[model samples]
Target chain A: MTTVPVRPPLVRSSDRIVAGVCAGLAEHLGWPVRMVRIGMAVASLAGGAGLVFYGWLWIMVPTADESAKRNARRPASPIAPAVSIAPSASMPPKHAAAVDPPLWTGAYSPGYPPGAVSTPPGGSAPAAGPGGYTPAAGPVPSVPYDAGAPSQPQEPSAVPSTGAWFRVRNMRYGKEILLGAGLLLVAAILIARLLGVEVPLGTLIPAAAILGGAAIAWMQLDETRRAGLVDKTKADQAGGWARLAAGLALVVAGVLVMVSGSGSWEQTWLALLASVAVLGGVALVLLPWGLKFWRDLETERAGRVRETERAEIAAHLHDSVLQTLALIQRRAANEHDVVRLARAQERELRGWLFRDPARDAGQLSDRIKAAAAEVEDGLGNAVDVVSVGDTAMTDRHEALVQASREAMLNASRHGGGPVSVYLEVSDGGAEVFVKDRGSGFELHAVPEDRMGVRESIIGRMKRHGGTAEINSSPDGTEVRLKLPAAAEDNGEGKS
Target chain B: MSTPALDGTAGDRGRTVRVVIVDDHAIFRSGLKTDLDPRIEVVGEAGTVERAIEVIGRTRPEVVLLDVHLPGGLGGGGREVIAGSAALRGTTKFLALSVSDAAEDVVAVIRAGARGYVTKTISGAEITDAVYRVAGGDAVFSPRLAGFVLDAFGTAPADIADDELDKLSARELEVMRLIARGYSYKEVAKELFISIKTVETHVSAVLRKLQLSSRHELTKWAAERRLL
Candidate 1:
């Protein structure tokens, strides 16, 4: 089994079919999400049921869960140092972590080649350590974790291999197309049945094949050409806006086929043919762009998740990991103990870093209860989450849950005493309240230490386009977050 | 995917520097171990604050390359490293490694008692150099960061007048003292219970109010004032 880089579930933007697997894959492989979607659509069209099979594969592919990840050992493949040029001190770390723009998006940073290393100009090299490092004199075998290379003596600075983008393959596109085409066939069959059209699998099979092929072929050819008929480097040089425009055009073509009307037996076949042509064309012309767009969306979402995870990881490190390491680093004269502590921190760090960022999007009541449990864990205080109005909440209810959790954390961390949390839905909106019996203060004078308050409650609420109100005094504080029923309104605004 | 574990560094007699890398990304850690020479070795890597500590006890790498944000904790969470018993003090060096050169993160890690601050963008070579420098009983600050440290400590001349310096809060003055002592921004934040942003604000305030242009000026003034 090919060992996929273990990552959190949500950050796996390449997974789009079931909770954004395609999006997760696109982000992971650094491809466009729209292209993945389009390609999958085309593939399903071409391969018929094969598309469905691909979707199944997506669902079955084991996503590395946090618990399993906590125990897995990361590959220590020795990486051969490439070069010894001085790294510029001014270059920010964020810039370093960001993928090479040209490789992923086709846009080039000013003065740099589309896929060149982003080294700053005239940076000073760091002072050499003890032995005054010897450079590589001969050919060095490229290994992922080879530290032994530097032990040999040579001449100039060893090549410092840094960020490298993984190449996205056409097979993935085929996989996506097949998956997409399968979905369309199923939907079409279901629609036909819903309309009370009597048809056997044998009869529908031929028609499905003909229509799916036509759709996949047409979309691929037309859209691929419109996608500028070039690869990533050349395409990115064209600009993101242009790529998006081209992708939209292909999507339009695909939509046209899905909706086009031609009812007669012969015309029905013709419509199927037309559908194939349009979808195939769309897939080819704009799928890459679409895939890229989708990937970016997923990436952004994952980035947020990653940020939160990082924050949580940071908290863990501050609270426990670093403290333990400090002890080992300072007073652990026993090499074994120090090594053990260091290893522990490393495990925790890897847990936070390598673990997936996706939250299990399950039932609403369960999720709320889970949120309550998590709050209790965080604050060491009991939390009660209640549901009002029988209608169930979906993952969409997370904003409300997060708001309540934040409020609870605030009450526990700074409200000066224990707290109670309540939730209810009324008047086309849902309300969550966190009430604490502890001493509170003026709302205007936000406590500097109250980061989680501003970030979790306020930030989450604002993102979901909701409102949070805080009422506090020396006696106690009550925090409430309200979400309008039309939360979907803001969902469409994301694009 | 179990690859062969390190052959338990055969009979290593002397102590090794325990280290942890904190960053939100894995690709950043890809070439880390190879970057540091024999003087420093990476025992583990972490993506968050909490896990970093957990692993710290397990692997016991002497230094941690701490990132500001991780999966389960805050960026400034590394304070536990500093506030811990002296047993942990000399054995580990929490060298904050992050994409955020954000003054807040820098000061925060410094106040957390991280021995050094270096951004992710630093070449594997510089990172290697940093590990060794920090290991050898010296505090390491990137040249650009040197100024922030000086400013945080308010190492300006007392003769510069109390009125001009009044713009700096008493907390800011405390930050200045720590900075002058060679603490990173992250360390400063942990020390002050302020965000890295607040720490930066203090540093900037001192720089602006005292009319001192660089860390060198602050250092000189502090030397004259006997602050260090």
Candidate 2:
């Protein structure tokens, strides 16, 4: 058993009858493609086991080039650094298109040239630009400028003994294909013997001759040109459809073989038992790698997609909404009107950012600061937010945030110059104190139309099962809000 | 953004009341200029506290249209600018034109010794009259702003701290007023019939006794205490 790399194994990008699994195996093992396909066909004719095994392989394997493209797009890979000049593997712009543009491109196209060893381990390099040649000292110069090489002694340590290296590396991927083909032939023999199909032990020699001739006719062609000719035999059929056709043909042929024989139930049972034993053995060997390949593929792709989405949203918001709001505020009727408009826009923008999934559960102190910053910008008040609690904001993040925002705005409106915000985690929850040094307003004296104190502050707190306290004097007014954590609320409720 | 005229509209008094508008809002400044008395010549305009000082130094206007809140040289807004431009004292005076009518804003600018405090809501003619009154050496304010100043500073010195004020001699107090009013040293010398050196001595002594840095801070210090 080959010890796989930490990252997913490479899959072949071209040449396949579904999922590029056999093609990928051929690349990994360097066997003639003819042998693998023949082995597959013979196994399929024994029963439906081979077809089922092939379908499993198709889903599990990620073609090598697809993995290479992923490698290029991924910023960091543990195995990548150990393999070669790994930096270029992460250069998406340089290699992504050159490798293969689509996820399933490998299943349809021919795998790279017989010269495939020259291709980067992370396949997508445009060195396909130069017939995939592995120049002497090739890997060291992968990145043209050679930026990181001088700093570390990584390469020489990696190369094995010269004789061993060449035997393993220059084998050019045929080793596994032949080995797998031989195994299939042995399994086919076992099935025949089980079926009471007369075994021609002497015919094995003729079968070898036939296999060799077929290998010679098509096997030497590894580059796209010959692979293209081989692919034409696929005849406008996608890999999955072609596999469907092959499986049906093999099943029909097997039925004829069976009917021509004794047609006994014992023969059918024997064939079924033999097929399961062989196919299960093969699956035991290949499935782990296939699962690893799929895991690697999903992880890299999902993360990249999410990052792209966030960047796009940020750019659009900055260019459109923010600019338009600024222009409107400047053109408003008077300073007061401008201030009011600015305050409203500030509130909306803060709310949007706070509610964004990325930073919604961040430190409550940071959220409080964001609210203070908005009021400071919109009203030109000096706001300082201080946090002293060791606990996180807990379940009341949004409600406490809104209530705090209203309090900050009120301070800017009715309070004197510098406004201070303090967050303290005392008891089982958080207390937010917003203080301003100014004459305080009479709670009862506030008009019905004013909502900052009533709806935004008091009402918001009530909804969250929190309490808001307002104290005023000639010196200053302080609004203190106590909010219980979500866990604490549940704990109390259960009792 | 308009270029304020260097010469005032001709008045029966026969003097062009040269003025510089130092408000941040260009549109409001221009609109206010259009409504001013023809006798008031809008000499120049500046948009920040720093530029206002530089523009005032060069033009030496009789009255400047200063905003109560401004950005640029220092953070204290109008008070910082008034404090920074000490050399232009007797030659020019500053009157604040602001959008804020809050008592703190009114008292703050008044303490900075703005000859007056008026809201942007005042009609053009009213602003013009206020400017002339300031130019003629009378403290002016919109009625409500005046009330804030009187309540805060004008009514009684008894509630005020006398520590800084007591440091000034009678002559020093007079000189400090001239300095805070934006009178140049030469003008102060001429008005007091004293040598320029004597006037300098008095100004520095007043600064030292008040624990102030420059004539800029002196004006702020005096205006803040309502000594002028």
Candidate 3:
């Protein structure tokens, strides 16, 4: 399913110096690639504004290959963002720029359009951007120019600046935003100093302290969030640790700045504040490692306790319940009631003892076994069910289970002693065979009034787009039910 | 407690079939020993993997009723016992006895060298028949074990000429289905117009394919389809 096709969707281009954001924008807007690159460089040097936009684009826009594959399957609506902004708002800025240049150049060159060499529709190539970039900027109305696209001078405020900032905040480039803000503060202070304005070290040092502490805290929070997402590569983990160390060093430097800046304060108060700052820095630095060690110890202790409890339970079961069941089976070997009761109790106890929690209760095997157990309990016939492979619970699978139950009931009713159910699930389809060894009845000879075989087993399967066949002979009767694979039933109502 | 006469008296005719019952549960072992038929004698018994290996090596019974899960010897269970008693492969056959419904465990023991697999819930008469069949150099296929073999080797390409060693023949598949449908070997022979010996031959061929064929797809299919 796709919405109205945007002729060339905005996606990150393969050709780029960094994460291909500016190249992608240039291609999308039919602007000169070099002009966009130069503009991005200028914006980045001007207090790190470009870095924020780069990180935001890296997080939001899919790469060319991703968009192409997505389009081939089901094109994402550009107007309506596919991923919600709330969960990602807490995500840390990914190190997209940390990707090596040689790998990208080698990988993306075969299928993608050449980034810098392609001429824009207005005939302004990257080489001619320095001379002819001005005329092209005025004509493009779809450009989302704001602080990020500072080179577009004609309609700088054409798009709402609030919208661009909203999208930025939505991406949640937490670390980049902090870095950009710190750069802006430094830039402002430098400009003020150049203009001979007296800048107070007292306020500056405390501000740096707050920013550094916030950066460290933000990184730690992001680490915790990402631990559950995907396993990080060793390089990614090392990079994160390095960034954390940088944040810690920044906080330490801020404390030094604070100690030097507080020359006018009383000596006792200064000593107290400095010692507190140093202790707090040490605690912050050691907290994650200490927490990790404590968690490991707790997990090991819990595992040992569980092991001991499980062994005790097994010993107790073997010593009491199992022994009693065996004794009962031997004492009343000819008594059907006592034997059946003991057998059922043993099955239950064995199941409880060695239950695998990973298998869900509603699985096909379990459902079939429950049906067989019910039939056995009701008719006093041994119903053996053996299943290979299983499918997720779907309506079609539910229908299969119902038909199997009906077949088992029929087998027990008409056919004599024991019933067997064999279920197999493969990629192609699922099939179940319920068989009984007795004098078989001819379906044609059965009166038309009997609804058990016709309605419950055959009709129900037909309604679910499956087929049911009954093979009968003097040897036995076998009911075969077959359902096609799930992929073939896409047009049907899944529920 | 005492080993039966090991003189070549166990046969398919009127002679007794010596059997060793190796299960982790002592109560079940004693119960099975009592429940066996008069023509079939329990020669030895063991509770753990190592003890089963040791007992089987010493008693050398005609058939060993092995459980799939055991407590000792690296936790490999019945497979380890079978491997440990490899020297007796020519004389002593294994019929795996399990209480659990896990197909992988059955498949593992079968692959190791068990001639057949049957659940513990079977009647004592059926177990005696299975032991006689194994002792007579015939592979036993309980309905559940037949279902497993069908699921494993039945999904190959229908053209038997392509991979005949790994794939089951159409006749073999028919026999397996009949067995899985609770047909006795005699009944299957009657239905297929073949002799009981031919039914045994087909089952033995399937068992041979299950153990000896080095088919990657077969291993993968068994691994993926059978739940642990």
Best by DockQ: 3
> What interface Cα RMSD is found for model 1?
24.3
lDDT of 2 by residue, B77-131 (tens): 8988788777777667778877553445556666566766666655666566666
Best by TM-score: 3
How much lDDT does candidate 3 score?
0.70
Interface RMSD value for candidate 3, one decimal?
A: 7.3
Q: Point out where model 1 deviates above 4 Å.
A: A1-495, B1-16, B74-87, B150-155, B159-228
Which candidate do you rate higher for TM-score, 1 or 2?
2
Please write out the lDDT profile of model 3 over residues B146-221, one tens digit for every residue: 7787777765445756656777888888888777766677777877999877878888998998888787776676
> Local distance difference test, per candidate?
0.51, 0.57, 0.70
Q: By descending lDDT, how would the candidates be arranged?
A: 3, 2, 1
Interface root mean square deviation per prediction: 24.3, 20.6, 7.3
lDDT of 1 by residue, B24-71 (tens): 578767667666656566667766556666677677666667665566
